[model samples]
Structures are given as C-alpha cells and as structure tokens.
Target chain A: MAGVDMDMQILIVDDYKTMLRIIRNLLKQLGFNNVDEATDGAQALQKLRDKPYQLVISDWNMEPMSGLQLLKEVRTDTKLKDLPFVMITAESKSENVVAAKQAGVTNYIVKPFNAATLKNKLQAVLGAF
Target chain B: MTDQAETNGHEQRLEALVSRYKDIDPDDLVNIVEGIINTAQGDLSSVNLKVYGEIEALSRYIHSARQEIASLRPDEITDEHIPAAGEELEAIVGATEQATNSIMESVEAIEKEAETLPPEVAQRLTDSVTQVYEACGFQDITGQRITKVIHCLTHIEEKVNALLETFGEPGERSARERKANETSGAADAELMNGPQSSEDAISQDDIDALLASFD
Candidate 1:
C-alpha cells in the first residue's frame, strides 16, 4: 500500500475454489484490493485477453489448461507479454521451476507457503510493496 | 451313415462304428439297450457324445467365469464403477474445499474483528490469524494429493476398461478410453508432475537460487 498501487488490477487463477479464496484473502491482506479470479487457464487466458491486469498469480496444475500453458500464451502475446506473472502452486520440482522461468514467470511460490513467503514473492515482482 | 473318412486318423473309431451297428437302425438299437446307449451305436457312441457335451458345457462355464472376474461389475464396471471411484475422490476434493472455505470464512471474520480490539490484542489476534491462514494451506496440498490419486484411479480405470474390452463386448467406455489415449494434447505435460512432499521436492531456497541464475 505504501510503495505500490493497492488498486492495481491483479488476476489469480487456480482450479481449486479454496485456493482461490486463500489467494484472494491474502492479496486483500496485502492491500491489493482490486483482484480478479479464474478457475483454469482457458478462462484466465480469456480474462487476460479481454482486460489489462497488472499481475498474474496462477497455479500450475489445472484441467483443460495449466498455468505454464497460460504463461506461454501470455509471453507470446505482444500486448500481454510484459505483464508480471507469478506462478503459485504445489509444484516444486526443479524442472517445473526451470520450465516456468523459460516461459517468463515473474516468480514461483510453492504450496503450503505462509503469508511471509507469499509477501516476499509478491514484493520481488511488484517492487517491495 | 455316410461312408466314414476312413482316414488313418479316424480309422479305429470308424471300424468300431461299422462292426457294432452294421446296417442296424441305430435308434432301434439304442431303444433296446437304454436311452444314451449311443441309441445309434448301441455302444460307446452314447458315452462319447455325453463326454463331448460335458466338455463343451465346461468350456462355456469357464469362459463365463473369466468374464465375471475380468469385467468386475460384468456389464457396468467398465462404463461406471471405476469412474465412480474417481468421482468419489473428486467429491472428497469438493468436500475438503468446502470445509477449507468455511474455516477461512471464519478466519476472515476474525481478522476483520481484530481491528476493533485493543492494539496489542489486535496484533496478537492478527498474528494468530496469519498462522491460521498458513494452516489453511493444508487444504491446497491435500487437494493436490487427492487429485493425483484421482488421476491414478482414472488411469487404472482406463487399463481395466481395456482389459474388459478384450473379455466382453466392446462398449462406449472402450471407445471413449481409446479416444482419450489417442489424443496427445500435452505431449510433455507429464514431465511437469505436481508437487512432491517438501523432502522429496526442491525447496524455496533452491527455487530462489534457480531464479537468480535466470536473471
């Protein structure tokens, strides 16, 4: 809130409803009140194409489409390519990190993460909010 | 009645038939002796026919048994049962998600209320609430684990359904499974397996180091 635009439009995508709520609540706690939600990559992609979002926080495993796929699509799009995207998922394999990095992820947050860890990941991309 | 093959293979059987019955009406001969007396052969033909019938019946029974075991639910297991198991796991995921949301809702209310309390009490309450938020993460991890299980169940269902097709009539499940197998939408998606336990998987520190390398 002090150093960042607390009103910046952010989109959080995950297939799990609870995870969505958790992320929304966490983002709210961090003073980023303007947030959107998508349940999977296809819906998230559609949302991204339709509007401008400051950041994308997505889970890696989802039906029909995964976060990595969504990131790849975003990176390839001229309009959305530079949008900051962070992947927050239970996937912690080394290759998963490598793949997300290759696809232009802003940061990776493994699952079972606490508020501190989430804040750190966010601050890294969003500039120390 | 027709001249036998008289081939070297069946010659012995043909000789017995010819000598015993000759021109006799086999039916009449059987009636005189007993019902199965080959009726026609008046000798081993009835016994041979009975043995052949028994063997045929046994073969049919064995095939039916194989169908029962392999098909599991016989008619519906392939189409329904395995999917049902996977559905049950999905339901569990749903139930856990519901419970997790309920708990988070309460935590949200608590966090909201913390603002009204005395500063020290509010800060303590907020800290405890943050812990609750962290604890809520179990829902995500467990949900992922359950999803992996559901995937496994679906895989097994596919395999079982394939075996079912071999033993029984091919049906809708088989066709659907074949279609799914043929579709390679994400050829290497399998390599990006979901998270492993902390001990088995890379840590945040490791990821940070990797990200630095990319930078």
Candidate 2:
C-alpha cells in the first residue's frame, strides 16, 4: 500500500444510495478519498466521458444500461479504454461474471463482502492499492 | 260447419287461454302460475321481466369467476390485501435504506477522526467499521428479496383483478390503480434480475471462480 496515491480519483456507481455510500465509505477507509458517485450506468458513462478517472466501480443491474454495458462502452471508447473497471453488485450469478469478464472487467466483487475482501480485490486490481 | 273451420276455432280458443289469463279468474290463475313457478324455478315469478337481461349477465359473470378462482376465498383475502402487502414490502425497503444511511454517516465520521488516533487504536476502530460496512450489505440483499415479493404481489393482484372484473360491471381502472400499474417497471430486463434463491442460481464463490481465470 506504500506508494499508492491516497488521492486517486475513483468513481463508484450504483442505483442503490445505501450501496453507493457503503462502497464510498469503504474506499475512504482504504485511504482513497477522491470518490465520485453516479446512481446508474448511464450517468456513470456520461461522467466518464466528461472526466478522467483512474477507476470505475459499478453495479450490474442498473436500468437503461448495466455495468457490463458500461464496461463495454469504456473498453470501446478510445479515451476511456484501459481504465481499471471493477464491478461490485449483488448479481453473483456465474453467467453474469463470465459476461463481465468477457466484456473486460478489472475485478468483480460479490455483495455482502467485507472490507478485507474489498481491499484485497482492489489491491490485486490496482497493484497493492 | 266445415271440419277445417271447427279445427281453427278450437286453436283460437286454446291460444286465448294460454296468452290471456287476465280475462278469466285473474287471482285464481295468478295463484296457480306462482305455485308452478315456485316448484320449477324457485321464485322466478317475483323477478321483473325488464331486468331479466341484467340478471342473466350477473349469473354469467359469477359462473366465469368461479371457474377462474375456485380456491379464492374473498373473506380470507380481501381485495385490498394484495396491494397492501406490496406497499408494506416497499416500506420495509425504504426503512432499511434510511437506517443504513444513518449508520454509514456515523461510520464515516468515526473513520475521519480515526486519522488522528494512534495506529493501534485506529486499526481496531477500522476493523469494527469494516464489519459494520459488511453488515450494512444486508439491506441490499434483503431489498432485492423484498422487491421480488412486491413483484409477485403485483402479479397476483393483477390476476385477481382480472377475475373480479367479471363479477361486476366492467369499467376503466381508477386513477390510483392505473398509476400503480404504470409505475411498477415490470418490463425491466429479467436476466440480470435481483438475487436469485432458486436451485439454479449460482453463488459468490462460483462467480469468483469465473473471474479467477482473469487473474
């Protein structure tokens, strides 16, 4: 965790306000303070287009567009491509995971996950962050 | 008289006797007819001919509804219960979400102040706060489950209403029920539905394995 920028701008997206708050709080606990929020995939997509974020953490079951769709969009966009994208959702189905992986996800965390799991996942994805 | 003339006269008198009871012994004839109707049709004599069509319609409606809801017990499950159940589940989601927000706010405050604490104490506080974060996830899971229930209740209400429409004069839905149907969002994508409880559903570990190849 030593050399990880604590001020790295992270975007957390979910339709559920409680979840967005929970994930943002956990990220804050991990020492990442510059976090932004979007309630759904469409808004998250618009935000990504407008800003430069180091990472995007999104939920999978949002309306109009899902996290997988956002991941695909990010991968396809020349500017947003190569960004570290993690999916945190209650959609723990295997097919959902496979779809996310195929669409190019940096990491996928299931719901009801603790801070330790989140930390390890983030560390693995962001290289010890 | 001719044989044909005699036959015609007999037919005319018989028709008069059948069609016009008012002409001969009106009270006596009424009593006889009422007795016959009671024995054969169970009080049909009291029913006005003008409303016979409405009575027949009602009878048909009851017949169809009975077939549709043979097990339906109106006394046990009144018309209001299904919608009420859906509303209650929605309220549960709202309450849990409010509670979670309050908890998260407190945790955030604690986390901020933990920065100044000594490493050992701050580490313990962080651990406790981490547990709280994980516990708060209960709201998300339970919210999904409750949403599914509300969908089911909405479905049952629709079906029951469809049947009940048969028992009464059909009319356009009231504004409140119309608003409810339009707002339910029942047509959303079902493949990425809320957490599944069926045997066919996969688990977190299975999801992890699917993503393991990426690592």
Identify the leading candidate in terms of TM-score.
Answer: 1
- Candidate 1 residue runs with Cα over 4 Å from true position: B1-81, B168-172, B175-184
- Where does model 2 sit among the CAPRI classes? acceptable
For model 2, residues B1-215, the per-residue Cα lDDT tens digits are 67789879966875688577656665566588668777764344334644676888988987876765655653233347776777789899999999998998898789778889999999999889888988998998899888777767666666655555655533243212433234233432544667766575676667767788777
- Give lDDT tens digits, candidate 1, residues B158-203: 6766666666655446423322224324532664467696687988
DockQ of each: 0.57, 0.48
How far does residue B83 in candidate 2 sit from its true spot (Å)? 2.0
True contacts kept of each: 0.65, 0.63
C-alpha RMSD over true interface residues, model 2: 3.6
> What is residue A58's positional error in candidate 1, in angstroms?
1.1
lDDT string, candidate 2, A16-110, tens digits: 88888889878877889899999878899999999889989998777567777788899999999999999888776676777788889988888
Model 1: lDDT of residue B149? 73
Top candidate when judged by lDDT against the true structure? 1
Steric clash pairs (candidate 2): none
